[model samples]
Target chain A: MSTVREMLVELTGTPEFADGISDDADLSASGIDSGDLVRLVLLIEQRTGAEVTAEDMDQLTTIADYERFVATRGGAAAQPNGS
Target chain B: MWLTQLAERNRQCFPDRTALVDEHRSVTWAEFDDRTGRLARGLAGLGIRRGDRVAVLSLDRVEVMETYFALARLGALFVPLNHSLTPAEVTGIAQRTGAVAVIGEAALLDRHPDLPVRLRIAMESEEFAALGADGIALPELPDLPDDTPVAILHTSATTGQAKGVTVDHASFRAIALGWLAVARPADDMVLVNCCPLYHGSMVVSLTYMAAGATVVLMPGFKPQTALAAIEKHRATHIWLVPQMLRFLLQAKAMESTDLSTLREVLYGASPMPVDIYTEAAARLGCGFRQVYGMTEVGGPFVTLGPEEHPAPDAVPDLIPAGRVVPGMSARALDDKGEEAAPGTIGEIVVRGPGVMRGYWDDDEATAEITVDGWIRTGDLGYIDRGGLIHLVDRSKDLIIRAGQNVYPTEIERALRTHPAVHDAAVIGTPDPDYGEVPLAYVVADEGTGTAELLRHVAEQLAPYKRPRRIEFIDQVPRNPAGKIVKKLLRG
Candidate 1:
């Protein structure tokens, strides 16, 4: 099972795109566009059964924020593949 | 007296009333008018003049609306660039339009450093903020004629290039009056517009504002954000695409969202699935209006009003595109260019005061799409006995993914650029989420793989335009004249 960080990295289509990126960096500024953000939210929901609310979207501006969100929602723990 | 006077009239009538709202701030009608005047003067100080073309690229924001009104005040043509386009595509459009100036967000401007424009204004720069400063005097605004072109909206071409649709002040004014007559919006209407301001759908926002309604603009459409906005602002009306409506329906927020204030939901750009429409209508307890039109014509000349919507439990019938609005006329023409009888499917064409002036600088292409004064809609439809337009299919092989147009020829052209790709054909396949998604059939050289082709196309096209799946085929079936037979491929 891929971690939240791994899924975030995969969204960029290459690891180098997310490499050296700070946890506090704005994902939109770091090449994650609005479309990608929507797709990421959908992916997290499908994989972890976690709900990202409208309030959460306003605060989820950085990678660290998203990671913290998933962890709090009980999605950070690894599960079996295709679970 | 179309756009410029509309702003002035709003200020005069309701100075304290909120005119525009975005995530950052809300502006009153008076403040909005004052800002537009100052920005127009600032742009004039930078050498922008009447009749000059200026390209604007930005996400949905109050500044985008300000720039549009500012340019319209000066009688300059506002050319809105789709933010999703590659740098090369942006450059191509900027060059073709002979744009003299470009204004956009700092980040978006950074991506297109080589755009063929004499001046660039970053919306977030200190200079940009100073554009609306108090000291600069407002320039003498142009007294634009009704026929003066105000905007150039680009539509993806069948030939893989983009064509600019030139629309004049009169076209918009006609559309506004016609829509007002049909919609009869109340003075207290508060609308949450989900469509991006760059596209032709901006007309909806502009038209609502002309009637002194408050419009809330989102940077982009997120289902949760949209639902929250509707509740927060007590929005009386909302406009979005059908796919967006689907997302909003599925959003977790929908369960707790207060939607009692929503009076109407306007959807367009693509057909609304019957099941989704029925479910949404029942749940939201709001009327649904389906607007139908194209960029080549003005935004929307036909509408399926809420009264015309079928009962939820009734046997589902084909939902018509609706009756033509005031100031517009439509008919179906047979292959021989004669008007088809009622109930006969044929190429739908429309004539109206809102029809676009012409394609920018392409008389031949413009002539091809226009028959007499009517614009060919490229949709196959027929008028029923009740005078409603019922669409059967699209004559053009254009794929609409989630509300954005994805031209198959453009994708095919990008595929052919790959070294190993011999030939490619693309078609639209139905999807439960997005109305349709592109499926590609490829004839490639030995050892070529889907990943390689997908990567190559990714570099050339936007994310939405990319193919969902590629199937290796022996050959792309074509006629003796070398025209691709997409029907066979669909089978």
Candidate 2:
């Protein structure tokens, strides 16, 4: 299972933009623009095969927050489609 | 002071129309006034008086609606706290602003347990039910002066430290009035608002209540629910950020939906990829007006109007945010204080009735931007020969390409056209010969590569203009406010 941050990295191409973000960096403080956040959230859902909604967005302030959100909601059927 | 006063002005002409709505809740002008008057009297009865700052920590509900005008009726400053803020962060702002009261959502006492204060006038659904469930009270009131401090909206805290923008009634009124001139609110002009009430865009939408407009309130934006609200309400005016714009673009029915009632969409909060702007028009019949203004000036001072770009030029060059509004004074100036000749990029400085009085208690920092009363916009832009302003970037975000300037906005706009590229950021990475080269940190859809992106960019740019290096990432770094923090990228 991929970490939520790893899921974010893989889906969003996070390495290009990971310079200053810490695991502790507040989503607002880390400088991830809304555009990036939208893409990252979509990617997590796709990778985990979990349904995410805006109401579910409350806990998405950190990678840990996303991990806990998706990891909990995701199960065996939650895996991304295999080629 | 503004919302309350405007509501009164509107009640005289259109009081019976629906003004505010949520799930299972709706308030008409007459109902709104009765409750607002009662609430203002209620707060006044509790010794909440003029100039007292009240922090509202609640979801977007009718109670929050009453809070805005009720505070305005008493000449108090309204501070709408972002519910998304951590308890500690909320407490920090509350302490810093010296708020006299924080009226929270009556049910959410458990959510924000550590706001550093105990005084809260909680309002909840059941309480509101009891409030007007039988009969609402009407209280006598008079118009408050326009200069009264109506709100202290905090900055988005995207790039640097967050600052409080002390917006006076007059400044707030100027913006709403400006919007009124173009974006009219017919009783049938249903609006779907998903942004936080704290942000000016939501406030702008809520102000349509003054005009008897029906508003579909989505406490926060959920892509599915946002789509549902539009279909149900036949919303005409939808407020959006670019990220939300993308979500709308991706919606299944976006192109096929009966968006006939949709007239115009107002989008801001962050600069968007121009391609995304195109997708919005294609997906929804809504012609968008891209607002370009900062929190200090309250908004939409310069906008890319619905008209297609003048064809003498192409794309963004043709699509520079149109001329300044009637009362506003705008100029592009170089460091030497001389007016930049048309087409010469310089700092955008604005002076007008719409500009805020100053940052709250930040005279020194305020002084740096306000030189002889003209607010230095900090954004680098230029006015063309046709008097339209084209933004380059924020002063700090300017990327020097060899000697030429490469605004990340320009590069981002270019990179968005490639079918495989999702997003891109251009930064000045240190180099030997050029001192600094424009390095592109790019995010591709899935399998796209740096070589393909470089070739894509190379086709559109000169040797000096093309990105010298590429960093592949899963995503670009952005703050909660939807701004790319170059400082973090450099780090």
Candidate 3:
């Protein structure tokens, strides 16, 4: 299982995602299309052991918001190091 | 009002000047017009009639010149079939259009190809031998209206069955006039052409030749041969697709070749990125024009001006599809059929002389898009305050959720922006409750885990626009014409 940030980091293959970029950055405003976001949703489902319905897809607004949803929905617990 | 007017006017003005060149072969206006008159008679002798359809299928040769002009003279429709398409496809088009004759040389008949045309004949290798053997009286062209049907071009059938688009003399005249207003074909300029004669760009070039510039044609798009010809003949101009531009830009002698003779390069048939355009402009050393048009409307209705290229303001503004030339008008309309405000997304509607008469024999579909006289292009996008058209996607490919429109193009654009995503396609999937939701298929440049993707984009999109499902594929399914085949994915 991988953290939401880790999953985002993997699909985007950007180290900044792994390290962390602002969750509020506009994904489209940041240049991400719904296609890339869809891949991200699939990654969340696989890593977090969560069933993400298409209806559930709309509830997410930012990386932090998504991570919290995954956490509440029993997504992967973060690594031992808080950092 | 007539196709012959283009050549006739030019022949009167430049009769002794070479009007066409191919493989060291050149045809002057005087010779082309005089012989084409006889060839029209030859075709008429073989029963090609006014408003008849003649299908030309062969390697690029001198006879094609005679074929085009002969048909133009008689007001018969000329159907240029792609030599690269499968024989079955050829047969299907021939059957659908009910062509009067399918003319080929010895090589094209090698596979014992069967066509649904009324007659089939193979011309000799010399091409001109037919003229010497049987001298037929040149048939005087009949008086025909510009609105008269001149050609029946088949739609690419990228998504489904091919439909014939009726191009009238008005449409042809409008296209040539509008293009010349910008391309400004030089009478003495040697135009090197390699696109298949069936394609719209090739036909446009034919009109340019008909306008009197010497035409240098190729059998087909062959990169090596194109380079050789450019070098050997000093071809002054070339028309190509973006893919061809990329290749031409890479030719070994591109920079060093005595390209001083080269004057302009015309490219269309697909959307191109800004970077590619910039590179091509700098390297090719010619004015670049982007053409945008569909089969229903006379092609290339809009083009981005040459001044827009590689400029600082080119971003988002330099749409390769230039502004609509004079006489034609464009409006972006929403689903309800009302005009969209500037920068608002909607389907594009066009009206002008260039608009096709209608889809040949498909009245039901014709009535659906064409209303009054405006052709409703299923393409979705917006017009800026300056009146430039920006394409988003076909209206059929739109995904609606809770009454909100989610354009797949916007989503696909987002996906391509990702560092790892090489390509992406977003389509609407059936939703029991909401009626539909978007599903995305991605092709990635590198192996990546899903968690990182979720973290990066989960917060970036609105709830309705988000993709509920995702899948990775080796490559998107595209038809022979390189357009993504979403219908196949739904199947």
Candidate 4:
């Protein structure tokens, strides 16, 4: 299965997210808007079956936060180097 | 009076009263005045002069409001670019407006490094914070006429390309007075505004503050944060789009939250689902007011007061957009450019002091939309015997099937009445037999079949108005202002 980082790159459709994007990079700053953020959360819920509530969505600001959020809920483990 | 004078008035009358509250901090009326004054001087130092257009791109923040007032003080036109726009789009708007300066957060600024503007100020940088330093010398304030252009607000572009609607100082002043006359916000009224500041909806916040009411701003609308802010601030009034209200009703925290202080909830930009309105009115125990207006005709010039709201058990009907507020006159115009008879469906046109001056630098487009000092609202509606204006739908959104007119809103409303249907959007799809047919995109709970929804819609609507297809989707695409982007669905 593709890692969360790869999914974000595909979802945002921004080339900048394909390479050298730190896990801590602000998703909003990387061209992800509020509508895009909502879609990302929905995608995560569909794939991981993790219940990301409205409150939880507010705290997931960076790419790493989403990965950890899914992993903590018993989803797939993060790949080394996020390849 | 211009926005600068309004701020100064608030400072003198309610100096110590809270004027603005964001997530991080709150500011008093006096402090807000002082900050804008210094920021105005700082901007002048950057060579921004009267009539200059300055594009601002940033998230909701205290600094954004500061920039608006500061620019208004200098008689410069504030051009707010929607932050969600791509870099190319931002550059395009800046070029179109001939903006000489761009002020925004660092990340947004960095995205468009080659913006045509001559000056760029990052709001997060020390350079920006120092713009409001007390030590900065204040420039002599300009005595701007009320007709001077203040801001160019871009339309939401739900239908097509966004156009910059030029609004003057007189427009805002008229809107403020009109809104105050209708809303009659009390002195102690505290408003929690849930819409983004970039959109024209910011005028609603300014209108409340004009009455010495305190306004709480959010970075963006999140159901949980909005509930918390209302509870923590004891907000007496809240402004949001109907979609936001829906999310608030669905949020897990809503039931546990203390909402006794809420007296009125203002909603607009689209019709409220009768089911949602009934549920909210019962649970929150607050009066609901519907505001109606277009970007071209200032922000909001008509209001459906709380008393006019339908009873919880009342059957859903075509709710009146409202009677035109003071200082504005609205009438339905027939296709021949003549006034339509009462109860006749025609294009709604409004004339008032609050109407926009024109579309920025697009004289042809401006001329096309205006007639005899009246701005065409592009909405089809009619005035009733009681002098209430009822909106039918956007002229472009009306679907014609077999030479019969079919309003998508009517069908969408019918589909929404289904127990399992969460939301629906109807659009015209080209058909060979019928030039166009109504097609629906619906977001519904699991196990809700298209056949079941079709049957429900058929029972409520005429045969011609029923959507030929009901496609299930996870969500209906909408613009930031909560209007369905039907263009996306049609594509």
Candidate 4, residues A4-31, lDDT tens digits: the string is 6766665544333335467788876654
How do the residues B213-311 of candidate 1 rate in per-residue lDDT, one tens digit apiece? 999999888988999999999999999998888878766678888999999999999888988888898888888888897888888888888888877
- Between candidates 1 and 4, name the one with more favorable DockQ: 1
Residue-by-residue lDDT tens digits, candidate 2, B1-491: 67776677656766777777876588887778767767777666566778888889777776787788888887878888766554555776788788878887754556666666546767764543343233545344546778878888876332223467888878867776665665544557777776668765555564565556777776655565576677777788787666676776664435445667787676665555556666566656456766666667765577666664332213452346666765677899997987899988898998887888777777776787787778887788899887788887767555543223345665676677899888888887764323456778888877787757756664444334557677888888998998887777888
**For residues B1-491, what per-residue lDDT tens digits would candidate 3 score against the true structure?**
45677777777999898877665477878878777777777777777898888888767767776677778788788887655444555777787788878776666655336776677767565543464235556555577788778888765432234567888888878877876786665666777776656665556576567567777777544444566677767777776666566545544335445677777776666556566667766666677667776667787778775676555334553363557867688888876888889989988899998888887778877888786678987777889888777787666666654223466765666566678887878788865323457788888866765554444344434444566566788898888997889987887
**Candidate 3 whole-model C-alpha lDDT, 0 to 1:** 0.67
Itemize residue pairs with steric clashes in candidate 4: none
Predicted chain A of candidate 3: TM-score: 0.68
Second chain alone, TM-score for each candidate: 0.98, 0.76, 0.77, 0.81
> After best superposition, candidate 4 residue A34: deviation in angstroms?
1.9
Model 2 interface DockQ:
0.10
Model 4, B1-491: lDDT tens per residue? 37888899999999999998988789999999999988988898778999999999887878889999999999999999877665655777888899999999787788779999999999888988888477666577688999999999986333324579999999999999998998887889999998778788788888898888889988766777788889999999999876678667756568778999999999886666666788888888789888887778888988999898887878376668888889999999998989999999999999999999999988988998899988988889999888899888667566644323456877787788998988899999875334567789999999988767765664445344567777899999999999999989989
Please list the residue runs of candidate 3 whose C-alpha ends up more than 4 Å from where it truly belongs after superposition. A1-83, B125-128, B131-140, B185-187, B312-320, B396-491
Model 2: docking quality category: incorrect
lDDT of 1 at A80: 27
True contacts kept of each: 0.26, 0.06, 0.00, 0.06
**What TM-score does chain B of candidate 1 reach?**
0.98
lDDT of each: 0.85, 0.67, 0.67, 0.79
Per-prediction DockQ scores? 0.33, 0.10, 0.01, 0.08
